[model samples]
Target chain A: MTTAVLFDNVSRHFGVVRAVDRVNLDIAEGEFFAMLGPSGSGKTTCLRLMAGFEQPTGGHIEIFGETAEGVPPYRRSVNTVFQDYALFPHLSTLDNVAYGLMVKGAGREERRKAAEDALAMVKLPGYGTRRPGQLSGGQRQRVALARALVNKPKVLLLDEPLGALDLKLREQMQEELKSLQKSLGITFVFVTHDQGEALSMADRIAVFNEGRIQQLGRPEEVYNQPKTRFVADFVGSSNVLSTKLCQRLGVKAAFASLRPEAIALAAPSNGALSLAGTIAGQSFLGATNRVVVDVDGARIAVASPAAHAVPAIGSPVTISFAARDLHPMEDA
Target chain B: MRSEKSNRAPLSLKIAAAAGLAFMHLPILLIFLYAFTTEEKSYQFPPPGLTTQWFGVAWDRPDVWAALALSVKVASIATATALVLGTLCAAAISQTRFFGRETISLLVILPIALPGIITGIALRSAFSMADIPFSFWTIVLGHATFCIVVVYNNAVARFRRISGSLIEASMDLGADGFQTFRYVILPNIGTALLAGGMLAFALSFDEVIVTTFTAGQQSTLPIWMLEELIRPRQRPVTNVVAMIVVVVTFLPILGAYYLTRDGDQIAGASK
Candidate 1:
């Protein structure tokens, strides 16, 4: 496969702080990729780097087959849907979408038709006369999407595009974005801090921590097999098994990740590994109840279905899981 | 708890409010009243008589017309000069960062902060030192020093309120520098520039002390009115000119107020 964007040991420093430090990454053409991390993890900085908004202090960047460094954003074959929506408040929706074409010296009539078509593509047909201030939050996001998409950039950069929307709208837009990417076959680079968004949308995920990529793989691989302790904790709140705890359980001494859902609170009949502990606390998640068991001094969480019975707090309990379910992880 | 009684103004406050209004407006009402008085000479309140003849005399006077023409021309050119220079200074200061940016901004706004007489004296000396003859252009030059400050104050406030992302978005959509400014920046700050230009024009139209220094032989409308007051010709005629000057300046200030009235309602960056 061809590389769409490449970062070769890219580094960006602001004073003494390294916002993006020595990062190496590649995205395939037409791939749906995600950069996921918490705030100050350099995820947003990386996105800005790709958009040509920030210059790296070291290393090189390439977009498609062309060198990207020192290239102004207007010259690059990429467009961004900004986090703030950034629609020109003074212009009508049609003019805002047509702005790209107008700047390119297209005929007025042709640009108007193209802008209208783009608006319709984002399911906002006939919204040409309304100002951005007149539209609702979700509608404004769709307009922002249309304004970027109208340019037909080779790559689309989305910086938390759904962040401002309410929950139902965010979920709806996620599904819509996935289908849009599929139909258009354009490379989409999405940056976000929400694990669920990254998991539900991106074909491949890169989990960032302190300006470094802790793990990079498909969603299934990243979730089922986290390479580092940070990835397991960040991706899905998996219980980290300390090397000391592994030795106590009569297993090889190594750091391992155990998902709470994988651990069942029931007596094992087929010689499966089991840990004895007291039920320290219980939280009622909508679909599953999370029970935190105090095994020795380590707090191990177990998620059981809502229909299952939960023991009272402070009661003794046994949590069971197969030997194959405990995946080893690095101490990082 | 707030009550209907609390919402109503106290009687004492109502009397004070009326007194303040009378203090401010009664003089202007006096000017309007005398503009129509039939008497050509000095003070007669509860005017001895009233007639429309002074309006005719004020209209026919050639000196009055010359001064009016000069005032309009100077104010127009000064305002245009301010719009260009003040807006550029504001953009340079607000949109980018460099050494001494704040110091430079302070200097641009200093002309209006100083007392008008100080500014007038400074300009007179500077022009005489340069050996530039006192003329219409000299008066315009003096007027621009302060007119530019008015525009800069308004333009800078509006520029700071605008989001930087709008410019970035324009570039991301393939707009060049000039195109980005035209399509994005200009539209967002358009009303502010218009408002600033109007205020600058109004200020220059009725300016007195600065014009006195720069206008060597000629008289502008306000300078002419000053001369008319000291060495009296027709006191009522001066009042007629005063009424016209008030209307000319009031229209623009009123327009500016309406244009920028909904400042808090300006759309914000998406939350």
Candidate 2:
């Protein structure tokens, strides 16, 4: 796949603080890529650098095979849907949607027709005459989407585009945005702190922590085979156990991450990786019963079906997982 | 029961507000009333008869027209100068972070905060040192000293309220820097600029102390009014012009209030 955007050892610093440290990433063309991290993890800063809003202090960025140095955002073949929408308050919905084409010096009739079509694609047809203030939050968000998409950019940069929406609306927008990207065949660089959002919408996700990409892969791959403790913890619920490998099970790392669902709570098994512990807490989820067991000095969580019969808080239990289920992660 | 308590304090507050309004406007009302009175020279509690004959007389005076034209010209020039400088300064200050930003902001605000006489004397001394002739440009320069503060205040506040992300969004959407300024930033700040320009014009129109110090022989409408007040040849005409000033100034003030009333929400939306 052709690389749509590449960050080659790029780093950005604000005074003494390094916001983005020595980052290298390659986002493929027509890929719906997500940068997932906690706030201040430099995900937003990374997006801003790609958008040409900020220049990297070290190294270079390439977009569509062209080096992006000293390139203003407008010169780049990319568009952004800002977090707050940033629809023009003074202009009507039509004008706001048509702003990009109008700035490109498109004719009045052409802009009107293009804007109408873009607005319709977002499922807001006759909202043309209403000001942004008059529109609902979802409608305003759609207007912002239409405004960016009207230009038909090679890449669409969404900075937590659905961050402002309520849960239900955000879910709906995530699907819509994904479908829109698929149909348009344009690259999408979505930034979000919400793990669920990234997991749901991305073709691939770059999991960032402390200004570095800990792991980048398909959502399921990243979740199942996390390379770092931070990635395993960040991507999904995993019980990171401080383990001394009693025997080599073909994995190289010293520590293992046992996913809650992968662990089986039972009496000490004869031929599995077994650890004895006392149950410290228990909670019953609808489908699964979660039990936290204190193994040595570490607390390990295990999830099993409610039908499996969970142990009491003080009951001694041996939690075991198959050798393959013990996913090893690099030491922190 | 809730409505009763809610209404009680507001009722007393309304009465107090009304009293304050009367206290402020009673003198202007007197001027308006006397402008239409039959009595031409001396003051009286109530006029003998209502007539607009003095308005006709005021209209006929060549000096009144001259002063009115000069005032209009000075106001127009000063407002234009202030708008350009103020907007440029505001955009410059808002777009970048530098050393002494707060100090620069304070310096920009100092002209309006200082007494009018201080600004006037400062401008006078500066003009004297430069040996520049005090003509129409001098009056405009003097008016602009304070007018720039008004425009800068409005523009900077409006600029600060706008989200930097919006500008970034615009550029990311394929708008050049000029296009972003023209389409995004300009449209967003239009109401603020209008409010600022209106206030600057109003300030320049009635500025007497600064104009007196800056204007050598050229007289503005307020200076003319002051001359008329001292020597009562056409006292009622001065009242007539004062009535006009009140109306002109009042409309823009009302306009500015309404424009800025929803400003907070505008800021929130941009963010």
Candidate 3:
């Protein structure tokens, strides 16, 4: 497989603050790659660098193995679906999609045909004459997709494309986007702050923090085996046990991550490590109950099925987990 | 009962509002009233008679036609100049960051913010120092100073409202800078530019104080109206021209109001 986008020690500094630090990454062609981080964590900045909207203060970038640092956005073979949709309000939906073709000097009739086909691909057929303002939030997103996909860029950069939608629509669009990317056979580099979105959509996830990638791996590896404290805490909220806490739990690793769902409150298992802790609080999560327990002054959370009875607050309980579920990570 | 009470203003407040409006507009309406009056020379609350004869007389006067022609020409040229210069200044101020950007924006709008007499005096002194003749072009140059401010204000507000992503999205879709401007920026700011141009045209059409200083010998419509008021030739004819001027200026102002009222609907504006 060829490398679609390569970031070789890319660094973008805004005065004293390094927005994107010396970050190295290789995104394989036709892969659904996600750069996931919180606000100001530089995930968005990295996407901007890829889109050619921002230049790195120091580094080299390649798109499809061609040098891409100084090339303006119009010259690059990449298109972006901006978070705000960015459909032209003045133009009809058809015209907004056809804008790229029109600017490239395509014949009017030919561009119209292509724009219509692109709209149809996004399941927005016969929406040509309608303006963006007339469409719903979901429809506007489809139009934005059609506008970008019409160009058939070598790499498509999606900047939180479904960030504006409600939960139901966001999930529906997430599935649609995954299938669409597969059918198109195009590499997608998606940037989002929501880890669930990154986990569900991306083939490979790069967890970013403080302007650097903390971990780069598949969703399962990143979730099941986080390499750093930041990744463990940030992705799926794994409990990062310090060296002292690990000792209390009979774990030899200096630092380890234990998932909330992996811990169970039960009448102690014979072969599992068990700890006595009082239930400090419990929150209702729809499918599960999150119980925060204080065990030897270390606050650990356990997710139990909501159908299961939750012990009253201040009630002592034993939380147990097997050795296989405890994963080790670096302190940082 | 509560809904009805909330919907209607008190009678005293309604009368006060009506009084304020009449105080401002009644005199202008009287000008429209007297334009068709038969009284030839003097003010009368209720006219001695009514006739359409003064409009014909105003139409026949060569000086009236000359002043009207000069006024139209100056306003058109001034509005056109303001549209170009004002749009360029607005684009620079709103689109990019540089040293003294806010200061430059303030200076561009300073001409209109100052009193008309101060601007007029400054222009006259500058023209004299430069040895430039006071003519039609001088009057246009004077009008353009304030006209550019009107265009700049409207264009800048709309420019700030336009999302920068629209421009970036345009470029990412294979549009060069010029193409991005044509496809994205221009269309988003189109209504604002039109409204700004209309307001500039209206302001320049009936301008008087600055024209008084710059027009050494030339008399625009407003200057001619002032001359006619002081040295009365036919009072009703002056009123006829005044009535026509009010209508001419009011139409564009009304058009501008309606055009920008729905401006919040512009895409990229909300975000």
Candidate 4:
């Protein structure tokens, strides 16, 4: 796939604070790329820079091989779905959706037809006459999507688009937005602080921290083999064991990251690393039972089948995992 | 289930508020009431008869017509000038930040905050120093000084309420700067501008102190009213015009209040 959006060493600073520090990223055409991070991690700043709402203090941004410097946002071939879904409250849904086409000076009939088609694409077939204030939160969000998508932008930027919805609605919109992105066949650069939203939607995820990308890879690759301690702690729940190299296990490094699902309660019959522990706590989580095991003054969380027999609190148990399960990081 | 005590204010406070409202409005209301009365010479409460002759008299007077026409001309010109300058100032101030922004904003707001006599005196001084002739243009200039503040306050407040993301969204969707302003920013602030224009027109229409200083021999409606009060030919006719001013000003104020009632909702939508 061709690169659709590229950020070349883009850095943005506000006085003494560095919001987006020398970030390099390339989003592939038709790929849903998500920037995942905690609040204040500069993911939003990167999105703003790409949208041209903010100018980078240094470096360059390109969309469709065109340098984006000194280009006002309105002249860009990208659209953003704001976190609050900034729909025009005074205008009806159809008018709001038709705004871009109207600005392009399209004929009134043509713009109306296009707006109707776009609203239909978002499954709000005939709610065109209603104002944004009259719509529900989910409907308002869909209107925002339709308004942006109606412009046929080369890239669609979503800044925490589903951040305002309730959990069930958010999950539904996530799937809807993913399918929408796929059907449109346009590059999507999504920014979200929610790891689950990023993981579920993105073809690849860039995990950010302190104004830099800590790791960027496919969701499973980043989750299964996180590059840093921050990534390991951020991407998914893991029992990150900080250990000094007692001995070299082949060519792998000392510090190990064992996924919760990979650790087994049964003792190792074969030559695998084993640790004796007591079940500190256990909780049933529908399909799985998460047990916190206290091992050598360290807490390691283990997830097993819900039907698996679990020891009582303070009961002694042996936790074992194979060498391959321990994905060690080369650098601390 | 509400207690009566909760509904009651302190007796002194209630009496004070009543006194203040009465003091402000009693004369204006009396003017309206007497516009229909038959009294021709001196002021009298509970006049001997009621007639609508004063409206006809005020309407027919050539001097009243001339003064009214001049007031309309000055007010329209001042309001138009203020709207253009004030909206531009609001847009410029809203988008970017630099040193002395607060000071500049304070200066913009200062004309309306200061006593009208002070603004009148300042305008008179400035015009005299520049050797500008005092004509209808001078009256417009004086009225626009305070009128710009009205328009600017309304426009800036509305601009501040609008989401920056909406403008960004417009641009991201392939709109140029002018297109964004035309479609997005302009539509969002249209009501605000209308409301501001109405208020500025009202202020300019009724302005007296500033017009007195700057108008020289030319007479606006308020300056005409001041002259009519001191040397009255038909006293009831002046009251009729005063009633007209009240009605004209009242409508726009009501319209402005309704226009801004949902302003918070628009602001909340962006957050």
Candidate 5:
């Protein structure tokens, strides 16, 4: 399959700050890919570069194998669902969605019919005549989606498109967007800071930090085997095993990262790395209980099944995990 | 339950508001009342009789017609110049960042903030130094200097209020530069520019100080009114023309007020 979007050594610098350091990436055609990072991590900047809103300060970018250097955003064959759903306040839903077709000089009736179909795809049928002001937050989001999809571009870039919605609505939209992408078979490059959203939806995820991609892989690989300490800490809650603990466990790596769920509260078993520590505290998290164990001046968290009996704060417990669970992380 | 104190203001505040309104509007009310007075020469507390003859007399005077036409022409040209220049300046300042950006904004607004006489004196000196002849265009040029400020203020505020993402989204949706502006930027700033134009027109119509310096022999309506007041001919007719000026200028000011007030509450910009 042809590459949908490629960034070759792309970098964007604003004054002294490097927003996107030299980065190379390739997204497959018709794949749902995510650029996941915290604020100022350059995920959104990379998206903007692909959309032709901002040219790379150095290096190059390509869309469908075409060099995108100096291309104006209007000439690019991509659509964006902005974080704030920047719909035209003056135009009705129909007119706003038809804006792309209208600009291309399509006849009124033809554009209107397509806009209506697009709205229906977003489950906002019969919302054509209403202005954006009349719509609720979720409805306005749908309108923005319809507007972008009406144009039928090869790639759709979503910049935290669900950022404004309430939690429940956001989750609902996430599912809707995933199914929509699947049905359309179009490439989607979603930029977001929410790890759960990225993990749940993206076919592959690029975890970014400090203007560079720390790790890029399938969600499970990034989660299970973070290549950098930053990726380990960012992708999820990770316990960085102290050097003393690493020595005690017979691991020779500089630093090891183990997920909270990887360790469990149980009697020492054969074929597992075992450590004796005092149970410092326990917090109930519905299905699982997170227990912080203090061992040799380091606090290690162990995820225990909530069905297990709770140990007293001062009780000594042995935590065991398979030796393979300890994933060595790159030294800083 | 809703508190009564929150629903109704204190009595003193209500009285103060009423006094403030009267203070600002009572003079305009006096202008309206004097326009109908039958007395011709001396001021009277109350008009001895009311007559509509002054309106007909003011309408027939050739000089009055000339002044009115000149005022309309100058205001039209000034507003046109302001719309083009001010909107362009607003777009530039709001969209781009560079060295001295703030200074340029301050300079553009300085004419409006300074005393009108100061602007008038500066314009006169500049015109004299350049050896440019004072004519209809000169009056238009003088009025545009301040009119542009009004339009710039409105346009810049609206432009800043607009989300930058909207422009990017428009362009990302395969719209060319002109198409993005037509669909996204224009609708957002249209009302603000309209309000600014109306206000600029009203300001130019009643402008007197700058016209005094730049108009040379041309008598705009306000200048003619000044002359009629000094010479004291058909004083009631002057009052009638004053009424016309008040009505003409008042409508646009009212229109501008409503237009800008609605602008603050944009149609779909709740968040």
Candidate 6:
């Protein structure tokens, strides 16, 4: 697979603050990639750099094998769906969608036809004449998508596009966006702080913390095989055991993390590392029960099936998991 | 309880509000009332009869036409100048950060904040020191000083309300800087600039003190009206001309008020 976007040791510093530290990354062509992080983690900065909204302070950035350094946003072959939608309020929905074509100096009739087609692709056909102010939040988001896609750029960068929507709408849009990206075969780079959204939609996820990518891999790889303590704590609810505790279990590693799902509430007949502890808390989470066990002063969480019997809080119990389930993690 | 409170505005407050409105507008109403009065000399209450002959008289006078023409010319020129300079100033202050931005903004608005008489005196002294002769352009320049403030006030408020993301989105969608401005920034601030221009026109139309200092032997509508008031020739005709000025100035102010009246929201950025 060819690399669509490459950031080789790219860094952006705003005075004393390093917003995006020197980072190397590659996004393959036609891949659905996500930059996931909390606010101030520099995920948005990376997306902006790709869009040419910001120039890297050091190192190099290439888009589709061409250097993107010192290029203005209009000159780049990348489009962005801003977090706030940012549709043109003064123009009709059709006009807003056709803006890119107009800027590119296309004929009026041709741009209008393409804009309408793009709108239909986003499932908002015949929404041409209405002003952006008249549309609902979801409709406006679709308009923003239509506007970005009208240009048919090499990469589409979405900066938390569904952040303003309600939970139900966000989930629905996520499905639509994924399907759209698949059909278009255009590389989609989505930046968001919502881990669930990133995990559910993106084929690959980059977990970022403090201006650095802690880990980057497929969703399951990042979640199940986290390489750092930061990633293990961030990607999913994993209990990271201290190095001293791991030595007690005969594992020679700086730190070991175990997923809640990997931990069994009952002792296994097969040889498995077991820890006896008292149930500190148990909460029902639909299909699963999250049971927090106090084991040797460390609270290890175990995700038990909701159908099974749950021990009362403060009750003594033993949780067991196979040795292979514990994954070694680097101290970040 | 809410209905009762809203329905019964306190009697004293109602009276006070009515009194305040009458105090402000009664003089203008009197100007309209006296326009039709048959009385040609001295102050008269409830005149013996009313006639429309003064309207005919005011219409026939060449001086009245000349003054009206000059007033329109000066206001038009001033408004145009204000539209360009004020908007440019507002954009610079609003869209970019620079040292002393706040101070420059204060200075831009300082012309309108100062008393008109002081502004007039200052312009007069400065003009005399510079050995510049007072003429049509001087009045236009004098009016533009404050007209620019009016435009800047409206333009700056609208500029600040515009979201920065809209500009970025335009650029990201393959629009150059000029294209983004024409397609995004201009539409957002168009109504505000138009309203500011209208207000500036109205202000310059009826201006007298600054015109008095800057106009050397030229008589704009207000200056003409002042001379007619002091010298007392065809007094009812002067009242008729005054009525025309009142209507001409009032219409633009009203237009400006409505244009900017729910202007907090720009086109696409409205919540």
DockQ: which candidate is best? 5
Tell me the DockQ of each model, to 2 decimals. 0.50, 0.51, 0.49, 0.49, 0.62, 0.60
A313: Cα error in model 1, Å? 1.9
Instruction: Kindly report which residue pairs in candidate 2 clash with one another.
Output: none
Name the candidate that leads on TM-score: 5
Worst 10 residues of 3 chain A by lDDT: A266-275
Judge the docking of candidate 6 as incorrect, acceptable, medium or high: medium
lDDT of 1 by residue, A1-332 (tens): 99999999999999899999999989999999999999999998998999999999999999998999999999999999999899888889999999989999999999999999999999999999998988998999999999999999889999999999999999999999999999999999999999999999999999999998999999988998899999999999999988888887677647888899999999875968898999999999999999999998999989999999999999999999988888887674
Evaluation by TM-score, superior candidate among 2 and 6:
6
Q: What's the lDDT for residue A94 in model 1? A: 97
Off-target runs (Cα >4 Å) in candidate 6 are A268-271, B10-16, B262-271
For residues A1-332, what per-residue lDDT tens digits would candidate 2 score against the true structure?
89999999999999988889999999999999999999999999999898898999998899999999799888988888888888877688999999888888899999999999999999999889998888899999999999999999888889988888899999999999989988999999999989999999899999988788999999988888888889888887787766453333345676667789888886546667777889999898989888888977678888889898777788888887877777878776
Interface RMSD of 1: 3.2
TM-scores of chain A across candidates = 0.98, 0.94, 0.97, 0.96, 0.98, 0.98
Instruction: Return the lDDT, model 3, position B137.
Output: 96
* Candidate 5, pairs of clashing residues: none
Q: In order, what lDDT does every prediction score?
A: 0.91, 0.87, 0.92, 0.87, 0.90, 0.91
Model 2 ranges off by over 4 Å:
A243-252, A268-270, B1-6, B9-22, B36-41, B44-52, B258-271
- The order by descending lDDT is 3, 6, 1, 5, 4, 2
Question: In candidate 2, residue B87 scores what lDDT?
Answer: 95
Candidate 3 residue pairs that clash: none
Chain A of model 2, TM-score against the native? 0.94
Question: Looking at candidate 4, what is the lDDT of residue B68?
Answer: 86
What global local distance difference test value does model 3 have? 0.92
How far residue A203's Cα lies from its native spot in candidate 4, in Å, is 1.7
Displacement of the residue B67 alpha carbon in candidate 2, Å: 1.4
What are the per-model numbers of colliding residue pairs?
A: 0, 0, 0, 2, 0, 2
Task: Give model 3's clash tally.
Answer: 0
lDDT of 1 by residue, B1-271 (tens): 5798799999999999999999999999999999998777786878999887888899999999999999999999999999999999999999899999999999999989898899999899999999999999999999999999999998898899878898899999999899988878887777888889999999999999999988889999999999999876778899999999999999999998887765435545231
Off by over 4 Å in 3: A247-253, A264-289, A304-324, B2-18, B37-41, B44-53, B262-271
Report the lDDT tens digits of candidate 2 across residue range B1-271.
Answer: 9988876776778899999999998987898899988877787768888888888998899998999999999999999999999999898898789999888888988999899999899999999999999999999999998899999999998998787877877787778878888888887787888889999999899898889889999889899888888885757888898888888788888888788766666655542
Give the alpha carbon lDDT tens digit for every residue of B14-121 in model 3. Answer: 999999999999998888898988877787769999999998899899999999999999999999999999999999999999999999999999998899999999
